[model samples]
Target: MKAQVLIRPKAGILDPQGIAVEQALPALGFGGVSNVRVGRLVELDVEDPEQLDAMCQKLLANPLIEDYEVLTSS
Candidate 1:
């Protein structure tokens, strides 16, 4: 099975990269953009999908400052 992990900073956390992108959008002709949050995606091939959450909690995402979601590709 193919697994996908989406990791992102938790709410109320400061995101400098997101802020930079948001600030540059208007100059690039894109407007009305707000609350931009940056995140990362990880793809893996695994035999068991159930273990993905543990992987996220242990290695993929920082439990104190980030959140993650695991998805399986059918």
Candidate 2:
């Protein structure tokens, strides 16, 4: 089955990519933007659905500074 792991910074964490995007918005004519939080899309195939949560907890995110969500059969 397919799974997607989305890792994002925890609240109160500094997001450099998000900051960069926010600064660039005006240059790209998206002046209405204020804040941006950057994240990623990681797609993978897993043999066991039950392992999905464990996978994220063990390796997908840094528990101290990041948060993650897993999408199953994606």
Candidate 3:
């Protein structure tokens, strides 16, 4: 099976990169863009579905600063 993980900064956490992007948007002529948050997408092949959470908890994401969602594709 193929598993995909979407990891992003938790609410109330300062996102410097996101802030920078949001600030630069208007200069680049991209308007009406608000609340631009940056995240990561990790795709991998897994033998067991249950191991996905463990992988995220251990290495894929930092639970304290970020939140993650797991998606499976066949």
Per TM-score, the best of the predicted structures is: 1
Overall lDDT per candidate, in order of appearance: 0.93, 0.86, 0.95
Candidate 2: regions farther than 4 A off? none
lDDT tens digits, residue span 1-74, model 3: 99999999998898999999999999999999989899999999998999999999999999999999999998
lDDT of 1: 0.93
Q: Candidate 3 regions off by >4 Å?
A: none
Candidate No. with top lDDT: 3
lDDT per residue (tens digit) for residues 7-61 in model 2: 8888899999999999998998877897699987779998888988877788778
What stretches of model 1 exceed 4 Å from their correct place? none
Local lDDT at 69 for model 2: 90
Per-model TM-score versus the true fold: 0.95, 0.89, 0.94
Candidate structures ordered by lDDT, highest first: 3, 1, 2
* lDDT of the structure predicted as candidate 3: 0.95
Error of 2 at 44 (Å): 0.7
User: Ten-residue segment with the worst summed lDDT in candidate 2?
Assistant: 54-63
Return model 2's CA RMSD, one decimal: 1.3
Q: What is the lDDT of residue 7 in candidate 3?
A: 99
Question: Once all C-alphas are superposed, what RMSD does model 3 give against the true structure?
Answer: 0.7
Pairs that collide in candidate 1 are: none
Candidate 1 residue-wise lDDT, 1-74, digit = tens:
99889999999999998999999999999999999999999999999888888899899999899989888986
Model 3 error, position 58 (Å): 0.9
